[model samples]
Target: MAGDSLFGIHGAALEVRAQRMGVLASNIANASTPGFKARDIDFKQALASLEGGQGGGIAAATKYRIPVQTSMDGNTVELSEEQTAFAENAIQYQSTLSFLNGRIGQITRALKGE
Candidate 1:
């Protein structure tokens, strides 16, 4: 019952997104580095994996690769793209936090008979 406090899919989804955000940020930061094949976050695949509820096998929710063109220096991150991803991730995180807060408040009210 205690574990029920977690927002099931929402909580897990947000965590995965947050982790992805970190990876994307790192890639962007190292965009100027030589031979760096930019990393990406597989949000859709992650969500599918969560929904599929599969484990102990091939992980579908893996960030496969970046569709980067061949660069001599080998840096593939685009500033605009990374910024966009970061903005979107931030919004999603905030929205999830708001939702969890509301859920907790609802439970609190129920406990108080309010």
Candidate 2:
């Protein structure tokens, strides 16, 4: 877990974001399926649980999303909303990855006495 200390919460954050992306993608994929309720992860709660030494996976933070406008088929997966969330989560995942890469580069340089 040395990397955990080196990367801080960004590591866990990246995992949560990745999981969230999958959930959002599922929502988008199931948009047409009747009675398919969209589920999303609570990033803050997930990260906190991980940091708190809770062994539960991100599934612990997964919850059904409340649609702003419900569809007649009882499906809660809103295409526009799911797409937007997926895009935002992807951006955040990339940002976290970049930060971790930068940190690793810095550590490598320090070890090389550069």
Which candidate ranks first by lDDT, i.e. highest? 2
Model 2 lDDT per residue over 2-112, tens place: 467789989889989999999999999999999999999999989998877786768899999999988999999989989999999999999999999999999999999
Q: After superposition, how far is residue 33 of candidate 2 from its true place, in Å?
A: 0.9
TM-score of each: 0.79, 0.92
Q: Model 1, range 65-85, lDDT digits (tens) per residue? A: 564464577667776777888
Off by over 4 Å in 2: none
What residue runs in model 1 are displaced by over 4 Å at the alpha carbon?
1-6, 56-60, 64-70
The 10 consecutive residues of candidate 1 with the worst lDDT sum are: 56-65
Highest TM-score model number: 2
